[model samples]
Target: MAETLDILVIGGGINGTGIARDAAGRGLKVLLCEKADLAAATSSASSKLIHGGLRYLEYYEFGLVRKALIERETLLAAAPHIIKPMRFVLPHHRGLRPALLLRLGLFLYDHLGGRKVLPASKGLNLNRHPAGTPLKDEFTRGFEYSDCWVDDARLVVLNALDARERGAEILTRTTCAGARRNGGIWDVELQQADGSRKTYKTRALVNAAGPWVADVLNQVSPHSAKNKRMRLIKGSHIIVDKLFDGDHAYIFQNADGRIIFAIPYQDHFTLIGTTDVAYQGDLDTVSASDEETRYICAAASDYFKRAVVPADVRGTYSGVRPLYDDGSEDAASVTRDYVLNLDTADGAAPLLSVFGGKITTYRKLAEHVMSELQPLLGFSLKPWTARMALPGGDIPNADFDGFCGEMSTRYAWLPQPLLMRLLQAYGTRVDRLLGKAADTADLGEDFGGGLYEAELTYLKDTEWATCAEDVLWRRSKLGLHLPAAAHKKVADWFAKATEIAA
Candidate 1:
């Protein structure tokens, strides 16, 4: 007989993993299945910020802003290693958005939702202040504010890890081929990773499929509800050589009211993006198109003194946001907040579908969802994820600097850059990745860009990375720094490893 579960969740994106953790922590037996590797979708292809989308203010999404603002500190406290504060420099122009209006917006942002750890917004005379050193002469005044940056994919994995540690079963590369309702329980059929089929009995089913949410309901759910069509809007991003000589990021407001961000990435690169376009392509094969690249380049070039063009792009990625279409004409205007749909009739099992979610709001969204499921499950479990740490996120005072200093002392032989890379990549969990290795040579292979064989092995063994793309594109952004030759080397290695396994 197959194992029974209190909840069976589909998809391994942030929402799915986050929900699994929250549900399992509440004395519920949970099973989360992903068709591909965890976070092999939109979770990894994000702008990589755990911030209150300041641009969303114009859309009047105050509730989302407040919730996200509160989460800014909550998440920082929850996971300090991967998420940290970043300052954005917004250079102002005389003709564009007047200073007063901008100040009003910033003022609201500062006081909106319980602001504590992060500093509030401040205005600066760019012509006189050092923050304006890289900007053009025409821009005089500017504003700066704080937001948290996240290791997007790792956040997904961390939640999955935490859930598993808390007695939840997370299955990757396992697809829910079909599911049917039997009495009060759900009979779920899963196609396992090793080409085997099995049955599972689940009381409730949660559909957190993200882009494929509707498809999972139509194809996998035996008892389904009619869903209003989800609008699949694709956002694309590009990485290039570091633009300015500063640690702070730049946020530029376009004439069309949409804003662009150019943030320092991986030390030597700057990450710029994201052109919002209505996408009708296959959700799996979404790629950054030439036109979208030009759009992003134009937006960046408009504000920066340096010219941005297609050739300068080091790497590009794209993700489709399955928004709960609110009938917005412009794709950019579509809401980022999530909505939940629960289908529970008098004599049937419950199916909950999650729509449009941001990386910043995944945890709270999970908590809210479990609360909604509370009555059906007949449990009195209150929220408990607020103060808990995700995997290696536990640092003193969430003090990454202090943690890094301590790590530096421990591994005195490793180069500072190399140490920082591993610390940032794996946080306090580096020991598991490194095993008992003593030095650089002990790591299995070197795939340029400081990507060692030890990290790859850990991913393959623990994280269900079947191929190189899972390692290069999803788990790490080494694809941006690796030469084409080095990139292929990884693919070849993965092929060899698979053949050996077979």
Candidate 2:
């Protein structure tokens, strides 16, 4: 006899992990499975801004904007270290939107979600502002607004961590092979990466498989509802050597009426993106097209004094956004808001399918999922995520700077740069990761680029990091800093470690 689970979530992206965290916290028997690494797809590939979708206001998406705005502050307070407040400089192109229209949008953005801790938007004289130094001379006027920059991958991992801590079984590299309803319970078969399979029964099933939402319904669970459709939009971004000196990011309005962003990434690089093109290709091997690379470079080159060419691109990434098809003529015009569909035909087990969600609204989406499942699952816990801090996010007053100061004093022996990176990555958990290590010598073998054996062990033992790619790219962007030799060394270390574990 298989044990029955209160909820079984398929997908390990932000939404799936978030829903798992919420359901597990509510005392429900929860299990979440992912086919690949966490945030290996659309969730990791984002503009990386927690904003109100300011441009969506043009299409009259006031509700979506307001919802995201509210979540923006909630997420900031919940994870001060990984999520930080950022100011955006939107340079006004003479031929594009008028000054009054920009001002009106910014005003609504400021007050829409009941603007609190973050500063309000204001007009900028690019001629005098430091952000203007890198911009073309023609762009003299602009608007400055507040949003937040997030480590998108880390956010997903933290949510999963919380869910695990609260008693959720999180399975990575495991695919929900198939599912069927029997006696009002879902019998699910999961296939692991090592060719092993496990079966479980779940009272309710959630198809939060992100890009594969439709596939999960049609192929994985053939009897499930198949009325919904997903619009796959490929958004691509490019990384280049730091284009400007300021911490601020730039929002360039393109001639096609689309917008692009160039944000300061990892201290030494400028992250520019993203193109919205209708995609109908291989989802597993999505990559930036040559055309998208040129498009992004051209878009950024339009505003910056320095020309950004495809030759200047150091790296590129692309992901397909699985959006709910709203029959929009333009790919960029498709809704960023999520749609939750609950199907309970003939009193059978419930199937909740989540479609088209942005990273910023994932938490709220999870809350709504729990709300929908409450009567069916019989859980009485109220919504508690908004007030409670995520894992290491319990810094007093949510003061990241103050927390860093305290950490500096406690771990004074660690290098300033290494300590800051760890503080940013793990927050309060840095103490746990560092443990009783007193100095760099105690940290063990140096893998170069500040990646020590101690941190690798912590990621493997605690964070479920199995491969070097997980440690280098997703867990942290140390791959960008480390040399190729160091990468091979990291890979060798993982191979040996996995062998030892097996």
Candidate 3:
């Protein structure tokens, strides 16, 4: 007989992990299975900002904007090690929407979220303000607002970790090949990485497969009769050298009714993105085209004195936004808000399918999802996740600065730069990774950039990391810094190590 679970969540992305974590914490037995590595899909491919998406206001996404803004501090508090506050500068253009309109939007973004932790929006005279130093002189005015930056992949892992700690089982590299509702129980068949198959029976099934939601309904649970559609829009990003000196990011108002983000990333590079184009290609093969590269570079060059062109880009990635198709003709105008379709067909087990969601709103989406499942769980669910901390996030009121100072003092033998890197990546858990190491040699071999053997081992051993790409690309952006030869060496080493271990 297959093992029975209270809930079975497919897809190891943020929403799946978040829902699994929340359900498990509420005393429900949960099993989460991912077709690939956690966050190997669209979760890690995000623009990596936890912003409220000020541009969405133009589409009147007030509810989404407010929920996302409120979740910013909440997420920071939940996972301080991987998330933090960031400021964005929006330069004023005379031909574009008036400054008054921009200011009003900022005003609404500030007040809508009941924001107490992040600072409010401030108007800036771009000619003299420090944020304007990098911008062209023609942009005489601008505005700055607060948002949060997150390691999207790590957030999913952390949520999965918390879920596991709360008695949830996370199955990475496992695919849900089949699911059927049978007599108030979901009979699920899974295909694991090593060619092993297992069946599971669960009271409920959650289809959190971001881009593959339709595929799941049609293939995984074919019996379901829910009418839902996913609008596939391709959003691409390019990582280039940091063009500005300040910590602030720049939000450019594009002429085609799209807003592009040039965010500070990795302390050495800038992350620029995202063109919304209607895509109908294979989800796994989404790549940033040459045209997309030129488009993004043009957007970046519009506000900066330094020119951005095709050659300046060092890395590129693309993700398919499985936006809930609301019949919007413009690809950029499609709503990012999510929807939960609960299915309890005739007299069978329930299937909860998740539609569209953003990196900023996954937590609340999870909360709402599970709340809808409260009646099925047969309990008066008390909300328990609001103020709780996720793993290493318990760093003294989420004070990242104070935590860094303490870490430096404790690891005085370590170089300041290396220690800072550790604190940024692992936060309070750096000590656990350090164990009894006393010097730089204890960190193991150096593989160029900020990557060390010790950290790589920690990631592989703990975070379900199985490949060099998972380490360099998704886990960290060091892939861009490592030369071709060094990159090949690391990739070769990882493959050899995995083989030997197997």
Candidate 4:
């Protein structure tokens, strides 16, 4: 007899993990399966901002903006260590939007979600403000507004970690091969990484496979709805040597009426991004094309004092957003709002497909998903995730600075730079990762770039890290800073560890 589950979620991206966390918190039997490492796709490739989509205001997406704005504070309160408030400096362009219109948009953005916690937007004399130093002399004025910067990949992992701690089974490298309805139950076939397969019965199935949402409905569940469509819009970003000296990020306006941001990244680099191109290419092999690279460079060059060119790019990444197609001719104009498609008949097992969503609103999306499933699953729908801290997010009153001060005092033996990095990555969980280590030597083998054996082992045992990429890329961006030889050492370590376990 196959094991029965109250809910089976397909996808390890933010939505799937978030839904799994919410369902598990509600005391339901749940399991979430991912074909690859968590956040290996679109979720990790985001612009890493928790904003209300200020550009969406031009499209008259007020409701979406309001919802996202509301979620901004909620998410910041939930995970202060991973999500920090950021101020954006948008320079006024005489050739683009007028100062009055910019002011109006910023005003609306400030009040749309009942502004609190973050300061309100204000006009800036860029010629005098510190943010003006990196801009071309022509720009004399700008506006500053509050949003947030986030560790996109870490956000996905934290949700999965919370779900696992709450008794939900999160199976990475496990694919949902197929699912079929057996009366009021769903028989789900999952294929593991080692080529073994298992079938489980689930009372409901959720399709949160991100870019593969449509493929899952069509190929994995042949009987599912066929009316929906997905628009695969590829957004690409580039990393370069630090463009400016300040902590503030710049939102540059282009003649094409699009905006690109140049944000301070990893202390030594600037992250610039995002070209919205309609994509028909392979999803798994997505990369920033030369054309997209040039476009982003040109966009950033327009506002910065120094010109950004393709040669200056240190690294690049791209992801395909699985937007719910709404027949919009332009890809950028497509709705960022999500649509939940519920397909079921005659009280049979329900299949819920999530289409189109942003990272800022993921928690609310999970709450909405549970509300849709509450009556059918007979679980207590009283929402609990809104106030609950995700895993290590529970710092007293959400004061990350205070938490850091306390940790610094407690772990005085650890290097200050390494301690800060660990606290930013693991939050209060650093205590567990550090264990009883009294000094740097106690941290075990140094894998260069401050990555130690103790941290690697914790990642393997708790975070479902299976390989070097999982450790260096998704779990942490240490790959960007680590020496080339350190990469091989990490891989060899993982190989030996796996062999030992086997």
Candidate 5:
């Protein structure tokens, strides 16, 4: 019998990492395993907003919206560097939803979660507002509302880092192969990327496998048919050259009643997307189909003065959302709220399966998971993540701009753009990467566009970044900014680094 762990988390996405961090902070021995790199899937492929789902109001999901709205401020304060306030422009379509209804909805949105830090939504005259410049000339009226943008992939990594710091084992490139009851504990088998097998005993198991939630239940708890209910909805997004000149994002309402966002992405591009379609294909090979790409481009063209075509699309990404099947046939109508299934059948070791959670509500979902398992796990520690900051989020009072000023003074020799990028990605931890270096030459080989060997080494060492994509796309959006030739250089560097380490 191996040493028993208090809990074992069987995913490395946002929900899984959040649970691992929460459990570890509550003084529980925890282990988290991911089949690939952290946030390599749905977690990284999100719309990257921390706001309450404004469109969800149509579904009468007031509670879910309120919870997420409250989390917007909670997450902003917790990680100011990576999460900050942004204004969303909702231009009114004369024949669609009326201005009064929009105002009422925005009113509820503003007050629903006790908003304190973010300003309230207000009416806008598109002709006068700066956000109106890119909009079609007909869009004379609009509404500006508040939301926060997050580095979704980095958020997952930060949680994993905090979990590791608090004594949880975070195993990337490791899959949870199987699990079975062994007296009062679970004998769990894990398969590493290198084909090695290891087993551990855990009192509780958490199946936060995202899109593969059903697969996990079927593999481990096949007898429990109740746990195998989920609907996979594929959402796709497209990135194009900068469509608008300002930082504000546009929320355009479609004739079909669905809304799409066109937001500033990576400073040099615009990100527009997300078409909801019932997904029934291989989860591992999900990508933006030509239809989805056209749909998003058309959606953007509907609102902007300038037209967006297939040729303008610079990149595309897609993910399958594993939503709880609430007997809804329409994929877009499916609920985004989460459901937790805890199986303690006939005194067997406990297993908790998670389904249908959004990124904005991951922390709350994690805290709720702990509450459900507190009695079974025999832990009485109070919840602490609500107030605690993630790694590099410890700036005084969460003042990100002030901290950036301080960093600029300290790294006066570094270029402003480069310094700002470091402060945004690593926050106060930038010092750890720069160390005692005094100039750009000490940072080592430049992979162009501010990517240097020093930053890559920090990612490989501290963040478990294993590949070029892991560092370029997920860790940072530098992949979009770097030239085509730079990718090979980055990949070669990673290969050489791995060889030396091995």
Candidate 6:
């Protein structure tokens, strides 16, 4: 027997989970399925910023910039625990765009999106600023602007969690093998990772498959009107040891007219990225090439006083962006705005295919997706996610620092670093993961770096985490801090745990 749902969403990236959460909250019976772990693709491989896309202003993408800028605070209010304010220092280069032009772009970035909460942009004399210590001496002037940094992977997981809590079924490691419109419902065949299969019925079908959107459409309805119209652009990033001491980040302009970001990451590494190249390879096999590595290092070394090389890189990741093929030749020139392609010809059930979106505006994109399908799906509920809090995001008045201070007092026995990490990752839910634990040993066997059996259990039971990679890389970035032997130990634990569960 197949359960009929109001909406069946394919893909578990930010957009998919966001739409699932929105629809579920609107009193719709929604089910979201992901081929792998949530955010195991483009959502997790982002620059990790919630900004107005300041560089987009040069291309006159005023509307996209404004929408993202407005979402900056909207997301901050919703997930204060994982999203925080970040300042960026953009040094002036005589060879690139003029300082006046830069100032004009910043001006638009400052006011385009209601301009509240975050500080306004200002000119800086790099020689007198603390951020200048690591920059080259030739760079004497710069501009400073405001943006927000996010735990990209955790953001996706939190959305899935919220959707699940709101009566949505979140099925991870499950792929939609095929789908078709039957009368007034969609019959979707799903294949699990372990080779099991299930059939589901839904009134509306949503293809929020980030990089695999086009492929999913073809599978659902081969020879459909919406087929083969996605531009696959690969963006690669490298993580190196901290380059500068300040909490602030730097945006450097390359001679080729593109910009790269050097931001402080995970408190111990500097995140540098991303090379824009036309990628026509398999999305599952994408990795950072040696050329992209050297390009990032060379680009950062040009502006910073400290020269960076390949040896400085500690980690690298790559993701392919499925931008709408607007006949654009250059990869970077494509618009980041999202376009919804709804196909309901011949009075059939609707199939909405999402194309082209960034992480910052995923919430707004989800809302728009629901608005488009409300009439077709026969739902009259109003939007409610704007004022709702994501799971564990209801910190006291959205003040993460103050909440941390109070938590430290409550759990004084825990190490300061461990406590801070837990607070940052789980927020108010830390209490749930650490129930009745008074000391380190009470949490269970230690896996090093404050990772214990208890937290792993919570992730497995609640967050749909199945393996060590899901815990180390996505749910958190603790893999970067853990020892090489610890990785094997964690993997062994999951392997044994799976056997026990089976």
- In order, the Cα lDDT scores of the candidates are 0.87, 0.93, 0.86, 0.92, 0.93, 0.92
Off by over 4 Å in 6: none
In angstroms, the error of model 3 at 318 is 0.8
71-143: candidate 6 lDDT, tens digit per residue:
9998998899999999999999988889999999898889999977899999999899998899999999999
lDDT of 1 by residue, 426-473 (tens): 788988997788888898798888888888889888777888888887
Q: Model 4 off-target regions past 4 Å?
A: 223-228
Residues 1-502 of candidate 5 have per-residue lDDT tens digits of 4578999999999999999999999989999999999998999999999989999999999999999999999999889989989999999999899999999999999999999999999999999989899889999999999999999999999999999999999999999889898877899999999999999999999999999888999998898775657889999999999988888888989988888998899899999988899988998899999999999888888888999999998999998898999998778889999999999877779999999999999999999999999989889999999899888898899999999988989999999999998988888898999999899999999999999999999999999999999989999999998998999899999999999999
Candidate 4 residue-wise lDDT, 1-502, digit = tens: 6568999999999999999999999889999999999999999999999999999999999999999999998898889889999999999999999999999999999999997899999999988999999889999999999999999999999999999989999999999888888999999999999999999999999999999998899975566544367899999999999989978898988887788989999999999988889998888899999999999999999888899999999999999999989898988889989889887767889899999999998998999999999889888759998888877899999999999999999999988999999999999899999999998899899998899999999999999998999999888889889888999999999999999999
The Cα error of candidate 6 at residue 163, in Å, is 0.4
Q: What is the lDDT of residue 11 in candidate 2?
A: 95
TM-score per candidate, chains pooled: 0.96, 0.99, 0.96, 0.99, 0.99, 0.99
Worst 10 residues of 6 by lDDT: 220-229
What digit string (tens of lDDT, one per residue) describes model 3 on residues 1-502? 6568999999999999999999998889899999988898889889888888898899999989999988888888888888888898999888888999999999999999999899999988987888888888899889999998888888888888899999999999999979877799888999998999989999999999888888999985675554356788889999998888888888899888788999988888899999999888888788999999999999888888988999988889898888888899999999999988988776568789998899899889988998888887675667778889887788998898998888878899988877886777777788777888998788888887767788878888878888888787777767777788877877887898888998
Root-mean-square deviation of every model: 1.7, 1.0, 1.6, 1.0, 0.9, 0.9
- Residue 35 shift from truth in candidate 5, angstroms: 0.3
